[model samples]
Target: MNEERAASEQEAVENDVVARVLASFENTPDARLRLVMTSLVRHLHAFLREVRLTETEWESAIAFLTAAGHITDDRRQEFILLSDVLGASMQTVAINNPVSGGATQATVFGPFFVDDAPHVERGGDIALGAVGEPAWVEGVVTDLRGDPVPGARIEVWEADEDGRYDVQYADARVGGRGYLYSGIDGRYAFWGLTPTPYPIPFDGPVGDLLTATARSPYRAPHLHFMVSAPGLRTLITHIFVRGGEYLDSDSVFGVKESLITDFVVQDAGTPTPDGRELGGRTWSRARFDIVLADSE
Candidate 1:
């Protein structure tokens, strides 16, 4: 009887801590903020109770998070990478951007995305100095109804054959990234290096976490795109290599079946869609049409 009473008292003490923390949010003016904070506190406390987490474990977690913040910089975003690997980034994208009406599905806006990518002429090359298997990418931008959306801006960025973005380089001269506007027929095309599977930046605390958890840090090869036109919903997505390694096990959990695309291999002599030859070198061709939702 005495032991049972002690157990009940302990349970009441834990509940009191949770209740007091939740009560602190009562005066928050923002409805959303209050709700979020209360829910976060409840869930976090529940998790701690369930795990019977010790002080050492909590301190270690704080240290790990501090290390993640310390390592983040312009070229590297450790928090975003942490969220990506935890599936939080993709979950937020899915919750906020539902793919109704055949609109393109959204994925993680990876850390490598840069604002103001240089504009390129239709069918121009984006792989300025990068070395990789040449690839010709052609696509059209249209509404869900298949009507052409002329003058839509298409921004594209990808890692090189070595699985590294241009920003990773010291000079970062806009290689493997560019933009183009769709023609009246909604057609746009460009040349770029075929994206190869690459590991996420695994040199810091996040890397240590992944290693400790025995998780791979590799992401599937893919071409990132942000297609936008006036009065239409902007699309942020990626066309992944159909047979690329890591598609089944993307560390960021960003792959969707619809995004997988065939990259047809061709001999160097094969004429490009625009009837251009590439100095007698072999290349691949891929096409990805985007369907945008109405912003309203």
Candidate 2:
């Protein structure tokens, strides 16, 4: 066929695909869902058109997606990792979470948060048997105006000094089930060895995709959180360690300037109820206030 004819045929195919997709959403009960799906299909097709994507490349992408799903299990979430690396997770947060003046910014929750983490008291150690620089994290959950949000619930999780989460280990008792929940007055504190920056899981298909794209896999050292209250929108965010090597180059593209905190090194001379003395030891401290939006 002539070049013009081939181009016309391609346009027809694209139009037909768009029509079918849009038609299927015509009766959608949810207005927001219909609008989002319609826009997604439009942009997706436009992207393919602009890139002049090949059949081989498209098939490869399909296979990659299939492999990502196949690798998911109760403990592993490949799709979230895929979204994170591709910046979709960040985009979703941006679109859904608009900052209200002084409200704390929202961020990606990451794929590692497990449900029902073991609850521990304030100042309890989440790093059970891990050896590294001790760190103290304390903060209050409040509104943009700095008013304390009493009874707010904040859940926390993070990797150990080795840059590994608890669920990643076969030995569940080791650093697994990290601390969760907040105390009275929306105050929460925990003790853990400082975590090191590490790469996301790279032994799987997601890794292969990143390798193919020449993208780095290192995420900045940070703690994960899910903060919520009775009358506010829940927040899923990370508190990045200041001065961490990967701060400016998070592999998952999840880091934000507002999220970075100075993990100050404290002397070991400080006394603790656990009988652990803060003598000449170094520790990191990050204090971030969570501001929740009033629920409608």
Candidate 3:
């Protein structure tokens, strides 16, 4: 009788799971969402059945998730990293962006973005207050047809030479705290030190997972960009530095072919805009245009 009762309870739990999963779609207003949810539920259940996942494994996953949550703070976004490494973030972007022929390819936004960075004028130096090799990044926002989209806003951010974002360190002694707004012609330029490849924080559970998987925690050198304007879809992407190690193996799997750009080193003898002799050191320059999709 006890064995029979156990079987009945297990069956009841399974049925409840199915019912609840199906019921979630009843109030979904969007037909697409309803369909997606239904399919997701079916596949999820199928996966469980296929795996025959043990309760111990489920408990371990829950514990890992709990640790991931516990490691998150204002500046550290382990959950975002978790989503990134899992490819869920990129998958969502791909689904939403849906290659429209000429639209810019969307990628992960990463976890280090900070709102309301101190804005600077066009061609201004974002790394002025910091230290590193000087670099000038200039670009225009255009449609796929190469027509400039004037007044498009290009929000940019990057890590310092030390591979740490401004918010990552509380000392304020590290660099990387600059923001630049593009001009009316969709032209934007800013000066900063070249960003270097760095390892993601490995003190958390996600890091532990990566370590267990024998994956390196280093990201390729890249600059983050978010371009948007009225009547255009926003683009969240990165311009990876060409020839940088880790391009083929980004820790978070955020690299894309179209986004890889060469960082040209200009001769130090070049004339400066202010008539000052250009510093006698090689500097990197990357220029890429962003194409935005038309908002339907």
Candidate 4:
């Protein structure tokens, strides 16, 4: 009887602690902020109680987060990597951006997106120094109803076959990133290096966490695209290689079935999509159509 009474008292104390913490948000002017804080407090306290988290474990977690912060810089983002590996980013995207009709599925924005990527002409080459087989990517932008969305700005970026983006290099002059606008037919095309599977920045705390959890760090080969039209919601997505490695085990959990595309290999001497002949080097081609949802 005495033990039961003590347990009841402990439960009451835990519940009171959560309540007091939630009450501290009462004066927050923003309703959304207050609600978010309250929910966070509730969940955090519940998790602590459920796991019986120890002070030492809490300190270790804090140290891990501190390490993540320390390793972040202009070239690398450990926090975003952390969020990606934990599947939080994908979950947040799914919660806020449910697809309507045949709109392309959304994926991670990744940590390497550059603002104001240089615009390129249709069929232009973006793989200036990328040392891989040339990949010709062509696409059309359309509304969910299949109407062409001419003049849509299509921003595209991808890592080389070596799995490195331009920003990863010290010179920052590496290629494989560019943008183009769809023509009257809603068509856009550019040349990029075929993407190859690469590990997320695996020299940091997130990598350490993944190793500790026995998780692979490889992400599937893919090309990132952010397409926007005047009356449509901007679409952030990736077109993954159909047979790419790590599709089933993407380190970031960013793959979608709808985004997998076949990268067809064209032998040497074959004519390109724009009618240029590939003399001695093999090339690849992929066609990915993007459909955007109507803006609210």
Clashes of 3: 0
TM-score of each: 0.96, 0.89, 0.86, 0.97
Model 1, C-alpha of 118: deviation from truth (Å): 1.1
Candidate lDDT values, in order: 0.91, 0.80, 0.81, 0.89
Ranking by lDDT: 1, 4, 3, 2
Which residue pairs in candidate 2 have backbone atoms (N, alpha carbon, C) closer than 3 angstroms, thus clashing?
Answer: 268-278, 268-279, 269-278, 269-279
Rank order (by TM-score, best first): 4, 1, 2, 3
* Candidate 2 Cα outliers beyond 4 Å, as residue runs: 1-6, 174-184, 268-275, 278-281
Model 1: per-residue lDDT, tens digit, 204-237?
9999999999999999999999999999988888
Most lDDT-accurate candidate: 1
The whole-model C-alpha lDDT of candidate 4 against the native structure comes to 0.89
Q: Which stretches of candidate 1 lie over 4 Å from their true place?
A: none
lDDT value, residue 271 of candidate 2: 56
> Which pairs of residues collide in model 3?
none
Q: What is the alpha-carbon lDDT of model 3 when measured against the actual structure?
A: 0.81
Error of 2 at 271 (Å): 4.1
lDDT of 4 at 293: 95
